[model samples]
Structures are given as C-alpha cells and as structure tokens.
Target: MRPKQVFVANHTSMIDFIILEQMTAFAAIMQKHPGWVGLLQTTILESLGCIWFNRTEVKDRVDASRKFREHAHGDDNNPLLIFSEGTCVNNEYIVMFKKSAFEIDVSVCPVAIKYNKIFVDAFWNSRKQSFTMHLLQLMTSWAVVCDVWYLEPQTIKPDETSIEFAERLMISHRAGLKMVPWDGYLKHSRATIL
Candidate 1:
C-alpha cells in the first residue's frame, strides 16, 4: 500500500466505507449533510478518521482540501479513500468523478466496488429514505455482498490536467465494474435507466 495514495472509487452504499475500513486502515472522505451528521459523529466515523466535506460552500470545500492534504501528508499510516463519484447510485451506473481527489499530488489507486443484493437492496436511496432507514434495511436483510477491487496505482502525467486524470480513472472504474456512464445533471435522476 502506498503511504500517500488516494483511493478513488464509485460510490455504491454507506457500507462501502465500512467494508473498505475493515480491509485496511484508511480515512474516507464523506459529504457532510445535516441529516446524518450527529449519528455519524457519535458513532465510529470520528474514530475511523472520516473527513466530512461540505460541497456547497467554497470555504468548507477549501477547508476540507486542507484537512485532506494534512491527513494525506501526516505521519499516520492510513491511506485516504475518496468516493470521487460524489454520491452513491444504484449499482447500474456510475456518475462522473469529482476532480478534487485527482488534484492531490500523489499516486492514485482506482477502486471498483460492486454490491450483490441477493438478500436486500443495499443501495441507499438518499433522496427517498433517511440514512437511518436505509441502515435499518441493511441490518434486517439476510446478507449484503460486497466486491472490492484495487486496481493499479497511477501517477499523473506532467502534461495531464486533473480532470483528464480523473476521467481516465473513471473509465477504468466503469469498465471494471461493468457500470454504465450516467449523464444526468440532477442528483435525483441517478436511478434513471437509460
């Protein structure tokens, strides 16, 4: 495992972070929303070194970047895991990756995660149900299958922009997961079948 590598992956469920954390000690960057903040803070999130990001405000985003850099550059042994897709979607598709993770001046490890809903639908429909509701759904289910793959680490080419690097990684994730590229601009449209 590279000391300062950023693991970029397609978001599937909240369980994605749990699964990854079980495998290795890594700090996962998550979006900060009012609904689940208290629950997350009181639980293992804080202990696991998760970074809560507020994507709406410029100041918050900047602060998040700084914290991310500090954590990535710190003496801690954990690598950083960033779900560049920005939000979770049904296993059918993957959205365009956010470019922040790609901008990190370090090797990037692209990851692909696929979930099997043999027992229950593990995809957290954040729009319709609350995180707690979805979590209860998962808990009551018979099983949730998680498949994670760590692809090769890549370095940004001197001539390549962060967006280009992110796109390349996105392609790899899509191919690996056999996921369709989602083109909708609206977050609620993520479940749309094309």
Candidate 2:
C-alpha cells in the first residue's frame, strides 16, 4: 500500500466503487444521492471506508476533502480512491475530473476499467432505473467482465498546478483504456464547490 497515493478512476457504475475497493483494498469517496439510494448506500458503504459526500454542495465537498486528508495523511492504512468524474459514463468517453481529488499534493495512480456488456449491461443508470432494479438486472446476467488496469504513479511536477496535473492524469487514463482521445472538457463546472 503506497501511503500518500490517491487512486483516480473513471466512474462507470455504482458497482465501480465496490469493485475498486475489492481490487485495491482502498477506501472510496462516494457522492451522496437522495432517496433510498443514498440511505441504502450510506448504510452499506460507510463501514467500508467510504466517505459520503454531496458533490454539488461546496461545504460537503470541503468537509469530505478534509476527511480525506485526515484519513490519507494520518495513521489510517487505506489509501484514498476517488472516482473523479463525479458521475458514471458509459466508459466510451472520458469526462472532466473533479479537482477535489487533484487538490491533494500526492502521487496520483490512474486506474482504467472497461466492461464487456455481452452478458449484461453493467452500466447503472440511476436516473432511469432504481438501484434494486439495476441489481436484479445484474443478478440475471451470467457474469460481469471488466478489465482493470493500474498505470504508473504520477507525481505532481514542481511547477504544475493541481488542475494541470489532474488533466494530465485524465489523459493518461483515457489512453490506458484505449479510448478516443478526449481533451477533458466538462460540460458543467462545479466552480462553486471548488
């Protein structure tokens, strides 16, 4: 386990966080949703080293970042895992990463995950379907197959800002996944939260 290392990845589904946790034994930063989804996930994931946060709220993001620093820089052994996209995409296109993950001054490890939807569509669309329905669909499938790769650790350059560093790592992760080069432009800005 590399101390002071932030694991960054593209968000594909709700299962993405659990999968990363199982693979790397690292804690994750989860966005707090409303309704049953939030309650259920909080109950299940909070014990698993997840830091529940509201992505749109500035105070929540700030508090979450502080908690991250405490856990990551303190004696706690689990490294910080951030799904920087702040939302799940189909994995074909990479989205702009949230800067909160980049705010930390540490080595960032980029992880790329690709899923084979032949057996089942693993992409969870919370806006369209409920969590239980998604889980039922997954259960009916033969299996979920994904390719997870860990790229080399990237350190912040002496002269580079966190925004630039995050953009660099985002490019690296997109390349690692063999995705069409995305310039890392976010459709929406969370400047208020930043």
Candidate 3:
C-alpha cells in the first residue's frame, strides 16, 4: 500500500480549510468553531470524520493529538488535512507551523494559498468580528481572489526532529507566497494580553 498522505497549509482565513476540502476527500483537524459555523462543524464536518478541539483547552488539545496520531496511522483511505499554523493570519505573513502534523510518519504535501487584497481583506479577525461579519464583508466586496500552489510532497528525514521537519515545510510554503515568517500564536497571545 502507498504511504499515508498529510496535506498541510498556511492558513490565512476561515475558508482555507474549506478550499482545501474541495480538492481532496480528506479528514481535517480543526478548531471547534462557534455559532452557525459550530453547528456545521458538529454536523457536516463531523460526518466527514474531522477532528475538532478547543484551542484554549489543554485537555482538548491533548485529546486531539492522540486522536490525530491514531487517525494518521489507521487504515483509512482518506488523507489528512492540517492547517499547521494553528490559527489564521493576515495574507501578508506566515506564522510558525505547529509540529504535530510533521510528527506523524506520513508524506506531507505543502499547499500555499495567497490572497489578493485588491477588493477586500480576507483575514478573519475573529476577536474583532464574527464569521458572519466576515462573510457579509466578502459578499459586499467586488471579489476574493487567491492563488493556490501544491508544492512537491515532503518527507521527514531519518535524523530530523518534528520541529525541523515543520520548519522545512514552512520554508517550502513560504517560497510560493513570499510571506513574512512570524509566530501566529505569539501574535495572538500578545493581542489577548493587550
């Protein structure tokens, strides 16, 4: 049998997961969203075998990790989709990828998504506005344009740690979009404190 595939992407907006979902029939690890989105997550997404967790809860994260590792190693036919940055960032930059996706022994396919802001900003700042607001803004805008590149598949080297593997994949992702590298979680934390 062929090695299992894990698709990883640099997340810029809420739609990043949805866009990737259209390309392949793969299950994803996602944050448990709120409102109508949460309803969909608990129903539609859950039906697809997607794993959901609350990012702020330590137990939820731990549980998700265990479930993710099991899913990756399982005999399921669908590949896994992961937004390794763990949170959304503006399109101008890419944040440090979480290493969990790389921890698995599977082929990693790095996908880069770049958005054109000529019409409207696609970044969904959930702290400032809700997903409903984001969608309304998009609906009123001229259009949302983006470019997605499917880079060559990567594998963790025999001697590499998961952190190193994640960094390497981040580099490949950065190559296509020319995004500034930043730790998204750090930015989020700082915003929370301020």
Predicted model with the maximum TM-score: 3
Q: Let me know the TM-score candidate 3 reaches against the reference structure.
A: 0.87
In the range 73-185, model 1's lDDT, one tens digit per residue, is: 66664788988877777786777777778777788998888887788887877668987888888998888887777778998999999878877765445444554455324
Please provide TM-scores, in order, for all candidate models, with all chains considered together.
Answer: 0.83, 0.81, 0.87
Residue pairs that clash (backbone atoms under 3 angstroms), model 3: none
Q: Is candidate 2 or candidate 3 better by lDDT?
A: 3
Q: What C-alpha lDDT do the candidate models reach, one value each?
A: 0.76, 0.74, 0.80
Off by over 4 Å in 2: 34-36, 170-194
Query: What is the Cα root-mean-square deviation between model 2 and the actual structure?
Result: 4.9
- By TM-score rank, best first, the candidates go 3, 1, 2
Which pairs of residues have clashing backbones in candidate 1?
none
Model 2, position 176, has a per-residue lDDT of 47
Q: Write the per-residue lDDT of candidate 3 for residues 36-133, one digit (tens) a residue.
A: 88998887877778999998899999999998888887786467788888888778777678888888788888888888889988899888997788
- In model 2, where is the ten-residue run with the lowest total lDDT? 180-189
Residue 158 lDDT, candidate 2, scale 0-100: 84
